[model samples]
Target: MEIERSDRPPSRVNWLLRRVMRYFAAPRLNMREDYEKVRRVQRQLAVLPGPRFHALDVEIISADGDHPIPVRVFHPREQRRDEVLLFYHGGGWVTGDIESYTPACATMADLTGCVVASVDYRLAPEHPYPAGLEDCLRVARLLLADPTRAGIEATGEIVLVGDSAGGNLAAVVSQQLRDEGVAGAKRQILLYPVTHWDHDPATSEFASVRNHGDDYRLTNTEVQDYFDLYVPDAAQRKLPTVAPLMATDLTHQPDTLLITAELDLLCDEGEAYGAALERAGNRVRVHRVNGALHGFITLPRFSRSLREAYDVINEFLDERVPGKDAEDAT
Candidate 1:
């Protein structure tokens, strides 16, 4: 069970996190060192318990077969058929992998009755920008082309789910699919997604960045560092795929469910995205998780809130995807 603090006191878990992160603070950092630190933090997620979804590991082969992408697929042990959720893990586009996100993917598969494919996309400062996004799209396309191995039918409804950097990729991939005349994904779920690299408070009017930007798990300094590492080029950051908020067309994008943590710096931009999608004539839902931090989905301390967030997803999928409820009942 996870604790719920209505008072929200900067989240004791997150406060301690801030203290732990201080040790790694430096100007010129090592990529290996950063990955090690994040891996240590991600291991904590293994301590949390949840429903059992049979997990499988396999390489998602791309066309030309130069390099295989690693992916973790979670299928409900009892359910024979379910929708597909292609999940992209978030670590500012640098850290985090399928193992780090196993619990969430397993829970998502079991709870939503969706076969969850948690992609281990390439990271930044090593693979850099577009590499991760490209890997994500390739996995989506390959799975859509033939999902049988993952226990999903070829024609099953697919949804894209991601957090932070992964959310950005999901949004971008949806647009790409739209442009390419692909009609597969029906919905996208974004958790505290980094929608834009350049966010102007005056223009966005999202005060969360100013109010809860610091002392929280995700700070302005760290955010900037992420951009420095992943998107070294300022010009590339403005691209629609890099920053979906800057995208000109959201008309044919999948139905969107954007989740924002009240205390997260990215909250405003995330909320702003929902409105933009709605204005573009797309069905959108933005829910601000009150008194929550950015990475609640992975932290055991926030499991109560995390569970609620999963419930929110359940309800959303029930409404948008259709047939999910019937599958769950069985």
Candidate 2:
């Protein structure tokens, strides 16, 4: 069972976390090293089996013009060419790759009964801002243009799903799709998405001691460090497209499933974005997973909550994609 600190005041949690921060609080932002650490942890977690999904590796072009972005696509146990999903990985836009995110892609494919393509965009402080965004858009367009290449069905719609930084890319790519007047992706799934560069003061109030499970954890400092690596260039902070919360308009985008973590710093932005979408008259579902922190979806064994989180994701997908539940059973 997951422990709950809801009864306690935020100050008490902060005080307790201070003593333990050294062990859990990640180091100062060293984009490369921190990125590597995340990949290593995810690699260890991926070894454990959860659901069955097939995988394949492929390549695409990065916005940097010449660099090739390696990608991995996950196909469900029983799938037709009609269902498709474009997935972007979360690694503070620094270290994550298709391999590091295979477990998640596989899990999503199984749950959603759709083919999932996980993109390996160039990381920040190297490729930086618009570069990664461009890579995401290019791949999405490429996938939609040639459905057969990704085994996408002629009748099915494309869906965009992402976590953390990748969630940011998914949002931008979805918005761009609308802007381009292309209609293919029917919806988007954002997992504890980072919707804004500006960390609202209210959200940061409970920065310390947010754990996905007793074993897998993330502290307030770690969140800030990730942002630093992701948007190292101070100037890019004002761009709303980089952070969806800043987008002038939230309407006309696809129906959205916004997941937020109760103890996470990004929670506020995610919830706020959901509210914005709802206010814009768009269909939206905002879910706050209690006793959880950012990155919980990636750590299933360390915490039962992670697996439980996937249950919510699966349910949401089943609802969005009718007949998914029946297909998953078989």
Candidate 3:
């Protein structure tokens, strides 16, 4: 039953992936050519074998904001369900968009039987700090206020889901909704999320950073680079709006499913956040999938680990959430 090494060594697929990633590694990050390398990488990956899940791409002008926020809605066959998920695509707060994450979103929609609305939030460096988060929060609030206007049924509930940098956005959004007394967000699913920013070079602590930091695709330094670009102000890093891990009050935050890859650099922070949420008395479940690497959710076609991750999420949803797979209104 236990094939993966608990010590978190690189799997055969990831070993090959490391080679491919290094091959496509970019020159450096700057404003002008920042997305080029990732673009190349995504192009290469697009050709790779992966699940083909299609969805209806819709454009909506936010009621609170003027930007044309593009959202991809994954509708199950026959009819649509009332529940919805606001998914944020992960690209280190810099490179990801809804298109890159469409396949995964559509798959999740099918699995969960809830319409998945993956938001095309503005990326960082070009947009920076609060810009992308603002887009997500606006989407949550606007959708909750008038779901029908956006073509989403009024389910009177929302689940926030994201991975990596997008997971950070999901956490902060949940915190804000809780703080503002917005009652719609009932659960949050954060996959290998970035929860804290203790940027002290001297501190090579934390079980994950000291252990699995090197072999993983998301290195500690790269994580720091993303944090720096997202929040240039060091003091602002302490703000709950930016980092939910630093939030003083974790009280009554949404019921959570925090999934962390055992080999990920962010594993400790994600687990710690789950602990803090438990301390705050919120129902939380955290899982560290064995031998999995970061961004596994986007690699369904390549990894069986992705299926395991889905199994955990589906178990959580069907067990905890009401209207689990309730028949679509014909």
In order of appearance, the predictions have TM-scores of 0.82, 0.79, 0.83
Query: What C-alpha RMSD separates each model from the true structure?
Result: 5.9, 6.3, 5.2
Q: Rate the local accuracy (lDDT) of all candidates.
A: 0.76, 0.69, 0.74
How high is the lDDT of residue 1 in model 1? Answer: 12
RMSD of 3: 5.2
Write candidate 1's Cα lDDT for 1-330 as tens digits: 112223333443465676555444432344434656766777676645655558878887755577788888887765534568889988888778887788877767776777888999887878888788889889888777778655455456678999888888899899898889986477899988998875443444568766655556676666667787788897898899888998888897788888888768798888888888989987787777777778787754247667767778887777844673484367
> Scored by Cα lDDT, where does model 3 land?
0.74
**Tens-digit per-residue lDDT, 1-330, candidate 2:** 112223323422555574564456454434345576666776777676666567877777654568887778777887634457788888777767787788777766765667888888877766767778888888888777775555444456667888888888898888788778886466788887877765534443223223322222444455556667667777787687777877887778777888777766676667777888788877787777766667777764446556666666566566644664484367
Best by the TM-score measure:
3
Cα deviation at 85, candidate 2, in Å, is 2.2
* TM-score result, candidate 3: 0.83
Candidate 3: residue 318 Cα off by (Å) = 0.7
RMSD of 1: 5.9
Give the TM-score comparing model 2 with the true structure, all chains together.
Answer: 0.79
Per-residue lDDT value at 186 in model 3: 74
lDDT at position 176, candidate 3: 88
